[model samples]
Target chain A: MIDPVLHAWGWEIPVYLFLGGMVAGFMIISGYFTLKGHHKHSDFSSFYLPHISLFFLSAGMFALFLDLEYKVHVWRFYTTFKFTSPMSWGAWILLVVYPMLLLNTLVSIPKSFRNRISIFDRISDVINRYPALVKNIGAANMVVGAVLGMYTGVLLSALAARPLWNSAMLWILFLTSGLSSAAALVHLISPDKTEREVSAKADNGFLIFELLVIVLFLVGLVTSTRAHKQAADLLLTGPYAPVFWGFVILAGIVLPLIIQLLAVNHKIRHTPVAPLFVIAGGLLLRFVIVAAGQASVIP
Target chain B: MSSRYAMVIDTAKCVGCMDCVVACKTENNVPEGYNRDWIVQDVRGTWPTLHMEIRSERCNQCDEPPCVETCPTGASHVHDRGGVVLVTKELCVGCKACIAACPYDARFIHPDGYADKCTFCIHRVEQGLDPACVAVCPTRCMTFGDINDPNSQVAKLLTSRKWHTLKAEAGTKPSVYYLT
Candidate 1:
């Protein structure tokens, strides 16, 4: 039986977290490509990815809205911003994100598409008039993307009630995972050989960092107080172990890492399967963390 | 000086009859399948020499409430009169951040899509009366009053007896105290 006291947050949360992290990941990569001029080589990197990132982010926000019991009262979140509250920070961040993503998407549209769409032509003309503005937007995307990535983890870590979530390593772990997942997504979609190689290499690096951060997170929890140790046990030897090991570790990180490495080195052909695993792993990581965190209450 | 309202529960006197639980439910009109207060039985030691401690649990109304800190809106705030942690339903988006942040597991999602928890019977206390739980407890095990007032029963009990708060290490500095 599910413990009543320990099951307040349900399935919706992990889904929200996963989507939020994915958006951040995609934004960071898209921003990086735009800034570094990789967009010049691949039209997919410049245009499609940023729009896709915004789409996913909007979907994620919708999921978050659905989770709210008082959906009509959501305006209250904007009435006053509390510096101490992570939720408040997240709300404001999301507010900034929508407009920023829209701006990026507008500027990245190809001239051919802009010619066909008069509104896009006018918007692109204005944006193209100032080269520095485009660069500034790209930089803003990178910064905002990083904050959005870290915020997902910080949101959970801020909750002191759940020992499993109160880890300093969580934010780093989440950011790296976002980066890896984003890279994997870009690698899967980009037709350019150089672009795919770069993203694949980056994903491999991010996966390594994510693995270390996960280990450190567990170490910190296990070496802490009794409650924290119990929280660690939830993932280590408790009911969640199988999912954590099978899905999050093996399938999500290790298997994806191996596949990506083989693909990068030309030992194996790059298939859609590796990126798919990375995305699934990213979603599952959020799911396991959120579910187990709720279960690891101070009973 | 303003009152800092608190509860001093004498666990030794409690029989776990759940009078307070029923009273709180009825008084607050808390939804079914949800609660504002309950009882916890902590069983210790081997079977032959086993001992069980039955304690009544409710919102601690923490001085440094994590729930308040985590709330996106100011829906969860400490009342100016007595520092009572209360939720303003109209402002609550029911994001469940406070529910996750509370160590005591005191808060619940009200059916109306707002967070709900113990209010220290603020309505009754405003009229200089005890909370419903304290008034109905058969053992008279609960003392509710201003902890800042030395003359108050809660203050007197706290000063004279050795007591502890649940999850003291949580750093919440809860207003509720339990006498062992």
Candidate 2:
């Protein structure tokens, strides 16, 4: 007795996927920043990281709010928490991550100091008292982000109504796609100097992973039972043919591969635009997959 | 006024004329190309061994309705009487959280863009009339009554017959029961 409402396409799911992809990218960017010794770099964390994270986080929250049937009910999601639901997990993550990113930003401000001591230092001292709380919050956020990154695929796979999406690979594909999109996004958004170099390598690594995942995904689509096969055929040669081949395969995957190849050959650094293309391609792939999965008939 | 109304359906008697579907639409003034309630035929297995089952499902008007709980705007709500789950389209911002939470796809957004679903013809029921679906059914497949009343037809039937509801796994505790 799957809900009919879940079957249809609304704008919000794609929007969430897009934002989720970006967030994944930001996580990698933050990781890169930490690894590259940029954690101590003055302008990197102080000016750029906080503002960018806030901008995306706020926009993600806005998109989340817009996806709900009852927008006001979202407030209680935080106030009255449910530890069981994935949505609750996502809500708790946003709750901690948004504030931490913001506070981490504010504390970096030189003016936010008590004499030689920064306000963040004071805030950290207070939070450090609740060591369990801080650890739980970080753990919850990473778990939530990881889950949220892959749940979009699960949303489709949960439907027994759609055979093509019912595969176990759905989650893996989603995870890889999300990681690829995220890496590409970081490449697009970060400063063009050192961060760009860090993201470039990450992008290359993820692109290889994306390609492998796509191959496995295609193999599963082709080798499944008759119902799934027909559904896959619909995407391959039926009404959704052009969208499946054109947007998803060509522009989204191939074009970026070509751009990256050219960048490597020219001895020129990959521009932010190259990675942005990959992110856009990933988003387009999710969109097409979602829509096509719905349009597929069970015959 | 603390009255919870629900329908008990006899699936064996239902020929699937879909009178309930049409009746629900007309009575609710359901928008064109949208249904408040519908009969879905679940066909499973391959040829020569295929099985077909018809379920006339709408809002089950659950005792613990997830749609009501998950709604961020309180647009989707339950009526105190009959436990009818009603959506206030006027209040709905159309975020679709209710859609995802509902294990039964009893709710749909009409083309005009508001949440729409079967109301059990509350207006007529308020006037002491049977819902349009029950009244119009030639085979009397649908039985409407207050399950709380010992004398009600629903209560008697529940005691005597084997019954089931769609997606009992959802734990929605649907008021609509099916005696197949």
Candidate 3:
């Protein structure tokens, strides 16, 4: 039966997308600093970010697991890989993410944080000996990070059945959103002033790009076809408008971006407000998009 | 010859009797409040100039099935016999990606933890019988056969009638057609 309302997904997917996006941001940030040889001023990028990302990634995986109806059949995802299926790609990416996160910690580990575990310390000592391999690992982080970020949106966009998520621009929007979120978290939690300033500045830039992508996403939808126009309306004037405009645009990106821009210019003292808002906004964006996408019908 | 099964439904002949719906439900043991097939009554224009189309709809069983392409575990697949879409429960992870990918709104997450939908009664078709819905259609409006066989009724109907597939713009190349 063809019905007007869609109802296949719920909160778990949005939460998972949000966490996955943040994890991607951390990897990109860490990779950037490690490759640039400026990790000394931003230990958060190399060391803490990976650990935090691991925690978040694990939680995100747990959320995905919870969303699965046949919990025991979860292993079926690994049995065969479908190139056209985003879930298959995501599963393999997630499996490799663990090693990448672990390898990242050992590459440029701070001494004070080392020797806590005998096995880890020995492995870290052995791995740190190879500078070239370590740098390659850093590069891998960025590449894998980027793929993971885009895959979250690609997962939705590949479903041509849902017009709202069918855009080619969705992956770019999600990737940018993920990078911005990672930068915001680093800005908020990093101890080093240089790291804070660098990440805050980057966050501001990403936030600006995210806003642009969001605008372009709707425009792309509205201008295409009738079903697509209806999808755009779901966010513009439909039920999802308030959360999209109020939380994602106003509170999430615009306000945080404004605060960070001021702080970057030394117009105001740095505070936790902006970064927190950015992170929350990133989460809200996923929820609203997923919900609205589900609500959009082909008719 | 390779068989490409298709269903040709005459909208002009169908009276919205719902016999097909009930037959499919009982034949498939579909759970309550869920259906493997259903009726849609679409009325256009005002009361003085009304044009009504009553369609008994189910899965389109498309040639380029999104459900098959999007299934991570190879659970949703096309039958080797006639390109009929079927979901194998043994490998299904119950992710509902198929449900989201189906533009027809045909699939549902089965309570037993797998994606479920109208299979066109593949078992019955395999046993050399008409599908329950087609067999029981009161007006004899539904014709099911291999469209690849030019001699088949379905193929003949398609040639003689002015018919259209739903959501043709979706590029699914649906197997079902509605004859005007």
Candidate 4:
């Protein structure tokens, strides 16, 4: 059994973090596609991704809400903003995110759906009237999505108590992982040949960067104080070693990279298994980090 | 003048009976299966030269508390008069950020959905009485008073004895001192 003192945070936190990162990843992928004019090649990239992003983000928010002990008093989170508090910054960032996502979803409505749905038609008409506004929205999405991706890692790193989380590399690690997962998602869903090829290539680059970041993250921990070294050991040689090495490192990173590379080189046909492993790896990364960080605390 | 209250604990005199832990829980009404204070025992060296050190630990009530700074709604704050770290239940969102930021692991989630920790027994201190744990110590190992007052026991203990604080590298500047 885990020590009671270390149980302050549980499964709810990792689930929330996974969902939050996934949403941010989707936004970044969709924003990049829209900005680079790749949306014309794939209908899924242009219209459905932002809506899917919103749905995932809303679900993540619900998970966060469930973690709070006082659900009814959650409104207090927005009453005042504390600059030093990452939670406060996240709350404000989320407030801006919802509206931007909604507008993106409204503007990307397909003509078939817009014709069938009066509300979508009216919304799309308002958006079409201000053609220049769409450019600004796409730019805003990329900026906000990047921040949201890094913010998840910054939130944990800000906690000085957890040696495993105090490293600056955490933000970069989380961002690269988020990007890789987002690209993999697009690769899986987009039927357009050109779109899939571009996404697959981007995901391969992100996976390589993610592996480097993860290595740096662990190196930073192991080279620091005794407490930090102990934190690193929890994943390196301790009880969590098998999962960290087997599931997270080999299966999550190596296998996905191998599969994506083969697909890019046309050595093998692309399959859903590659992206599925990437997503699983992303979620496992958060869970291991959270659980091990808590376990490594000095009593 | 602002009063900076502090504690001076003599580790040599601590028997590790957990009286302070019991007293703190009772005085603070800490829920079952939770604790506001605990005793940590460190044993060093091999069998022939074995040496053991036991110390009762709780919130250090640091001067620059990370818990207060990380609290999103200002629920964790230092008491202005006596420098006691406290939690305002009404404002706490129960986000557990303070718990994560506290290196000492001194804070816990109360059943009422708020962060809870040792308040330095502010209710008793305000009435000019010793905190429950301090008052009930059989060995009189724990000293509590305004460290700024030259005449106070805690002040005299600090001046006369060699002392150290826990996790000095953390740079929190804890008010609680331990004498070996």
Tell me, by TM-score, which candidate is best: 3
DockQ of each: 0.61, 0.18, 0.60, 0.53
Clashing pairs in 1: none
Clashes per candidate (backbone, < 3 Å): 0, 15, 0, 0
Residue A220 CA displacement from its true place in model 2, Å:
4.9
Which candidate model has the greater lDDT, 2 or 4?
Answer: 4
Query: Which tens-of-lDDT digit does each residue in A1-299 have in candidate 2?
Result: 32244326556666676666556445444534433335445445333554676786678678767766545545555554443344545556666566545544433343434356556567756754564544443344345546656655665665544556666787777777776776666566655455555556666777777778767776787897676788777778887779767876676667776776666566666766677677777777777776676665344
What are the lDDT scores of the predictions, listed in order? 0.87, 0.66, 0.90, 0.84
In the range A1-299, model 4's lDDT, one tens digit per residue, is 11124236788888778877877877777776666655555656657888888887888888888888777879989999999999888888999888877767765776567678788778867875775666666777788888998888999999978888989999888888888877888888877778778888998999999999989999999999998999999999998899899988899989989999999999999999998899899889989998888877653
Instruction: lDDT for model 4, please.
Output: 0.84
Candidates in descending TM-score order? 3, 1, 4, 2
The residue-by-residue lDDT of candidate 1 on B49-121, one tens digit each, is 9977778888999999999999989999989989999999989999999999999888888888899888999
Residue A299's lDDT within candidate 2 is 48
Chain B TM-score of candidate number 4: 0.96
Q: What would the per-residue lDDT of candidate 3 be over residues A1-299, giving only the tens digit for each residue?
A: 43322237778999999999999989988987877767655567788889999999999999999889899999999999999999999999999888998888876677787777888888877866777777787899999999999999999999998899999999999999999989988889899899999999999999999999998999999999999999999999999999999999999999988888999999999999999999999999999989988877788
lDDT of residue A63 for candidate 4: 81
DockQ of 2: 0.18
Q: What is the lDDT of residue A294 in candidate 2?
A: 64
- Sort the candidates on lDDT, descending order: 3, 1, 4, 2
